[model samples]
Target: MNFDEQINKLIYDWEKHAMPVLRGVAGVNSLAAVALLIYRYGFFLTEEETADLFASFDLIFLIFGMVYLTRLLFQLDRWAFIKSTWLEGVLNLFIIIHGAVNYFFGVKLLLSLSLMFSDANPVLQYQHVLSCYLLLMVMTEVTKLSTHLSNLNIKPATTFIFSFLLLIGIGTSLLMLPASTVGPHSMKTLDALFTAVSASCVTGLAVVDTGQFFTFKGQLVILFLAQVGGIGIVSFATFFATFLSKGVGLKHQSIIQDFLSSEDLSSATQLLRRVIFLTLLIELVGTVGLFFSWSEELVFDSFGQKLFYSLFHSISAFCNAGFSLFPDGLNTSILSDDTTEFAISGMRIDIRRMYGLHMVVAALIIFGSMGFTTIEEVLSPSKIYDRVKKPWKDWRIGTKMALVSTALLLLLGTLAVFILEVDQLRHDKTIVEALITAFFQSVTTRTAGFNTMDFGSMKDSTIIIMMFLMFIGAAPGSTGGGIKCTTFYVLLLSAIGDIRGQKNIIIGRRAISPTVVRKAYSILMFATTYNVFAIFLLSITESGNTDIGILQIAFEQVSAFGTAGISMGITSDLSSWGKVIIIISMYIGRVGTLTLALALSSTVKTNSFRYPEEHVMIG
Candidate 1:
């Protein structure tokens, strides 16, 4: 046979003969008997004696690092390793143990450290904890990216859920541990789960003052949760594998690529490599800029403090999570505080200087807000190389839609907020400063929730503007919330199509698919339905509030649901049920309102043949 034919035959034979053999033994999970034995026997230890158990965790991680290293050296294919003979199956037990113990112990270490938080200083404690979690998160995300970049079949989302669930289990176990005298009061399961969810979700709406509720340990735990949740644990796994191994399997690549998303047929490894690289690039630059920007005022503090602040804000901003160590968030009060203050604190800025910082921060927010798909498409090396070579080359449709929509949204958002706030400039500065703050507020309103002024005092018109910004949200597969710019683009385009009597919505000379149009419309409809429902639920749960107050709550609820964290100073006053509603909204917002819906939507086989066309009544 010819070379191509021979290769195809080889692949066909391998899949036919080899894959099933491996599947029989290595499909999923460890031996049920071994797991049962461990569960049955492993829970007999007391807290006082468990130090050794955790210590073993460190060793197990070291062993995994070594085994994966050895596997790298042998250059054995993932399929070869996964489908090893029965003799090698004996060793697979150790492989499973190594992976499991390392994961278990690593998770426990974080949970234990959180339980030991002292009251000495929450900022200091959380700073340290957030660092550790970021390190771990980056490691895990890298591994995830590496696996996906290398392979196309490994499931990144499933892996992410598994790792997160593992951490939750560890957190639950930690909450059950004996209460420390220095830590905040004991955690009820619901509260602990709530705290964990908030961190993972990266939503800052909390029942307790994250600052004072937990001992330094408790807050640190929360910080770790935020950092982990913010960057995506799968991305951490992807980055970790990158540092250790030279290449990833295609199956692993598929998993990571699926999560990062992209255009055309780019490989997952290339996509993940860029994603991890871009994440670090933005964070490092942001941290350095923040540190230097604040260095003059924060000189009296320890070196660690400045670094932690830089790191915390960098990750938090890029994640598009509106978490702040400050209880009131990035309020005017924080602007005056030396520690957690904005970079502009105490340093008098000329209008020009103010403009520069405004531009810099706005750029960072924009970069952070851009979706993974946007980054992969517009900024990726291959696309960049092609574009450089071919100046007239058209951008990918997603990139075009994202960039155009984001710019328009920001411009419209800025103009609307400025018009509303023109008469309400309550700050001390020239008209330039008012513009700067308004511009920042405009950018922040779309879901970053980083504010320079009080949102509570805004005009009713301003509240409506803020709601629209929050509802439109960031681009598709991005960190921010809303209906997503892509959805917005398609819906608007579809409307335009109807107005023009076109068969399909067209953009940049390309016909937008009906499937895409339908999905976008569905997302918009569901978002509207859900927001109304959230308002109804909140009104019932927190009845007796003013009309304005109700509107504010409704606005914030939708924002949170969109993963847009803008609040009108009412987040702190939410009732328990109200808080739960907000929490659910935040979860849906981050995971995506439509993403959750799609996940819940039934998946079934489709006919290969075309369906007969049918027309329905007009809207």
Candidate 2:
């Protein structure tokens, strides 16, 4: 054999024998990284203990560097391997440079750079950067491991369900760490689980004051859970796998296709990319808008603090997670109190009347709840280009239905809130302020869960209205939950058709399929049944509390099931059993009840046969 051929063969054989062992070592290193992170940040350590942990990190980095070099040496297509793993390559290069500089020159590069930005706590800042690096490494390994999930003989629906469960488990464990809370004691197991589930489900129901109870590290964990949960764990995994692995297997694509609701298998990857891109783009825009929209009276410790607040709220808004750093939600004095004033155009104005932040968040909630499919149909560049080329072409029936229904719902909600709450408005609040608040609440009630007005003090009639809005929820395949707007639209159409004595329900000159109609009603039936059972359980569990009325219980149950985070100020007062019931409701709501049923049901279908028809009594 030629020398090149011999060398290639030698490398191949060596890799075949050595790669598995190296991978096993790498796996251990990843776990060690996780443990180190938890140790370094999740607990108080002595000076010596901290030094030893840093030493361990250096060792881990050295091992990672050696593994990457070995793989590069053995790889025949070295350039291709580096290109595919450019992110890892960059990280390794940074580690090698930092290690060499620290060892030989006695210079802490990361610490120096951090000091340039802020002189305060440079050591802590350096440690945080290292923690972030470790986190990225863990995420990389997780994406690599996720590619193997398709090999398991399980339905996509089952896998999807399990993915959320796994995410919640991890989040719970992370939140239970000592550093996750503000006090000396760690979070209770039940409370941690509830928060984890709430964040993972993007439900926004909190048993504790998020801003007051959780430390920065804890909030970061919650933020991570919310982002992953909002987009879906499966989609995130698949996107990273495809981006980092160069390509995904057909089976993986099929699974992604199922999760993303893509009609074309070949387009699944493209759709995944578009969904992530759109999400980030919208979030970025929202962040910028919020950065400028905050009232001047709201003081932050630093620019970084302000920026973080903006980013956190932006993500929360778009995810419809409804998490806020403020104690009173969007209605807090720092956000919208009437007494807080800001100078605008050389005149002092009530910060509550500014309304810019509320408008931005409301817009984000509307877009987020509209679902990716409808967004793509309306806003995708290719679609826009095509529309420009052919102005006569109309939107798809599904898009039309979603848009029309959403508009009608928003208008109805706004008018109802305005009329019902007119007498309840404070005398000092102006007409414009009341209208703005009404508009904001109307937008948030459907699924966003943000509150500018106090629901606890509102009329019971208004609470009933909000519950109906929550029940309808957002559009299908969106981040928000409930029966879904499309399902509600279908039900409405079916009812109208029946009243008119029509044979088939039609919209936009096309008849919706019987299967589609059946599925819509099935979703409604399942949602209603589940809500009734959950409310009944809550009633039993909360019987001891005389202050908790049926209206509050029913409202809370509906809010949880709809993934709407709004409450009548009784969330913290719930008994342990009541919390557990709400947790299950949030899970069921986030992953549709029909999806959970499919995951649990037998896959085998019974044979189809004809049966004799019989007349039945009408309702």
Each candidate structure's TM-score, on Cα atoms with residue i matched to residue i, is 0.71, 0.91
Ten residues in a row with the worst lDDT in model 1? 26-35
The local distance difference test score of model 1 is 0.61
**Quality of model 2 by C-alpha lDDT:** 0.85
Superposed on all Cα atoms, model 2 deviates from the true structure by an RMSD in Å of 3.7
Residue lDDT tens for model 2, 1-619: 9999999999998988888888888889999998998888889899799878987888888888888889888999999999998877888999899999999999879988998898788887888888788778778777877888767888778888888999999999999999899879999999999999888887788988787788888999999999999888888988888767787767678767766656789998888888888899999999999999987866655788788888988998898888877777787744223222222233332335558899999999988888877787887888899999999999988788888888988888888888999876545577887787888888886678788888988888888999999998988767888998889999998999989998899898999998889989889999999999999999999999999999999999999999998899888899999999999999999998888888898966665886999999998
What 10-residue stretch in candidate 2 is worst by lDDT?
Answer: 335-344
Which segments of candidate 2 are over 4 A away from where they belong? 1-17, 73-79, 97-122, 334-354
lDDT of 1 at 266: 44
Score each candidate by Cα lDDT.
0.61, 0.85
Which candidate gets the maximum lDDT versus the true structure? 2
